[model samples]
Target chain A: MQTVAHAVIAAAGLGSRLGLGRPKCLVEVAGKPILEYQFDLLAQVPDVRLVVGYMEHEVIDTAFQLRRDITIVRNPAFRTTTTQQSYWLGGLHIEEPCLYLDGDIIFERRTFQTFLSCAEANAPLIGITEAKTEQAVFVAAEPDPRTGFLAVTGFSRTDRSLWEWANIACLPAGLLKENGGDVFTRLSRHLPLRAQPVECFEVDTEADLELAKAYVTRLHGAGTQVAAA
Target chain B: MKPNTAFCFDLDGTVTRREVLPIIAAELGLAEEIGFLTQMTIKGQIPFEMSFRLRCRLLAEIDVATVAKIVEQVPVDPAIAAFLGEHREQCFLVTGNLDVWIARLAARLGCRVFSSTAVVRSDGRLGPLTSVLRKSTPIRELRGQYDRVVVIGEGQNDMPMFEEADIGVAYGGVHAPAREVIENSEYVVAKGETLCRLLLTL
Candidate 1:
């Protein structure tokens, strides 16, 4: 059983690189807003906060239309601040253990479920993947001797072969409250960090969005085949 | 040397013993629904702007006189009033509540007020909202005038002001200040007297 009761989705970015007129979360992946898929996966988590900016009204409207009870926190300075700041703003409402996911991600349901189930015991779970890309944030980690959990040591951009952060993780609320700066930076500073491998991709550029769409299409096709079988 | 300090207070919870809107709602017999919405807003489940507009619409039919009466009965922290009295020139009531509804309280407090403005129709009902005060805007303005801007607030809406101010004090007099506010604040004072004393030290 997952201990975390809250989930914080950092969706305040303008995603200027993606060149999407709206926020990245509002962009559709499989004929539906990307956030709708996120909301669907996070449905079990009782308290969910969507930190919105850059066409926030549309995001809020869409979010409410999807789930009436999901909380919305606005990072008014989203234009000037970083994703870390938006996460901090949304982090305020999170009381229990929480699963924090970046807004731009589109992943298989199994990917998140794996992270959640694996993260309940090893808190401050940093979701990492060997699937490195141009934007991959390489993490330095070592496996724990006692529990065999990967303890994160450092984060760097220079290394390409190392496991990279998937921008999805479950963290204890206490650890979150004590930290400042970017979530990745803060996690790196705090030792004994647990790492979990998950299959997820972030949609940063137009190319990334296309990749997400393709991935979602493949997922739908696979689901359809399973049903037919 | 004493720094030129300006005290910016979030009105609803930090200064008052209870939230004004829910109190007014209770008086108007819409407490259950309004109170739920208020809780939702405070919990960050709903955007403050959306919740504020919905609450205002719910209270639209309510006469100004009745609101005034309810406002009169609303309990403000005595310690806050005392603190403001000692430093009236440097203190300001910065609230998202309407100027018209809070005018009497502002006058009674005798401090400069920065609040949302509302238009009143000829029949005395609130018309369309003219301006919804974003707490950070005034805090930013105050930063230009004061050497040190100290913001004291308890809600999610107050987080912006806290971000803008030089010193953010999360007061938990009515209830525990929201976690985000507390995390961002320089000082966390749970009691009204302690909050007043903390202000003096700063």
Candidate 2:
């Protein structure tokens, strides 16, 4: 399995849905800031680059103290743009099969273990969840009855789907050359959804943040279990 | 004017002995809050300028007399100080430290200083202006203003300015950066005097 050297965490949006005065990434979900947990996870994997905006100093300072190995980049346009712009602004720092983690996510350790297992398998992986209660993004996955390769396909149109996008993706890092936008932007145009059952989760609202905190705590207490897809 | 080259020099580590705010915060008993913010800024959890301004505002609550007394304990890099004195017009002290220190530093070095300033009330309570002046924008603006622009510093805050400068020197005498800034800089000089003595050729 080829190793990934640079994991890029995009943290440049005012998560208005969270209703916090600070950026969603800066909001403390448990004892740790949501972004800090993500950084801790990335520190376990490989070296990383973080793209930050909004209250950037708080983000940068917190991250640096956590892991000095990270490469900090800025996206000052966070106020008026989307995560796609933030990720694209940090494209130059991408190298290897970069794991792109949304800064506002909280999940089980098994979720990451499963993703890592799938990631090392050389197939481009996007962390997806089985627990879909809200308006979550997901991919349709069913055995192709004939050729036997999993058929993963779904976009914004397929609201009622089997699996939801956990807001985390793993790309070859060079895919940006093929399409100039983010993973979703390029995948929406180029590839169909390929599903892997990893319980990755996204935290959008304050309720979601609380849920994530509890879920992650439970997952940690139970220990990791990597599901074979 | 021969297309004045704007030389942006970071105050702490680059121009001074140590990180000024962190030191002052330690002195004023706000080290815990300030330290947390400092860690966040370096970690990419927060912006450098904002954290810096926040620290300044926190420190400004103390009297100017006390601050000046505390600042007296602050040490300037003699080599860089002399270098700026010799090339006064071209060099600019670009720091996130407050205006009081900026003015004091500029006067001491005989160069212009561009930094954030806090509003001190008659009752001596300090309040931050909160307008973010990014260190990166100033470097770009200076680059446009001058035939050449150079930046010197150590730490993640200096990454953008270092990336844009015609001559980027990371003075890592106090705290050496992990690897990113070390690799990005054109020159890495740890000794303050060694870097100053070498700057004559450039």
Give candidate 2's error at residue B192 in angstroms: 16
TM-scores for every candidate against the unseen true structure = 0.54, 0.55
lDDT of 2: 0.66
User: Which portions of model 2 show Cα errors greater than 4 Å?
Assistant: A120-123, A131-133, A144-149, A177-183, A220-229, B1-202
Residues B1-202 of candidate 2 have per-residue lDDT tens digits of 2336667888877787888877778888999999999888878887776677667667766875566556656788787888899888788877766665445556777888777666666775566564545577778877767888878888776777777787676665677654567556544455566466435434
lDDT of 2 by residue, A78-136 (tens): 67666666665555434457677778876555557556655643456666667453556
Shift of residue B85 alpha carbon in model 2, Å: 28
Q: For every candidate structure, what is the RMSD over all alpha carbons to the true structure, in angstroms?
A: 12.3, 13.0
What are the per-residue Cα lDDT tens digits for candidate 1 across A139-216? Answer: 887888876777777787776546888888887765653225667777776775788777766888888888777777
Candidate 1 docking quality: incorrect, acceptable, medium or high: incorrect
Best by lDDT: 1
lDDT of 1: 0.77
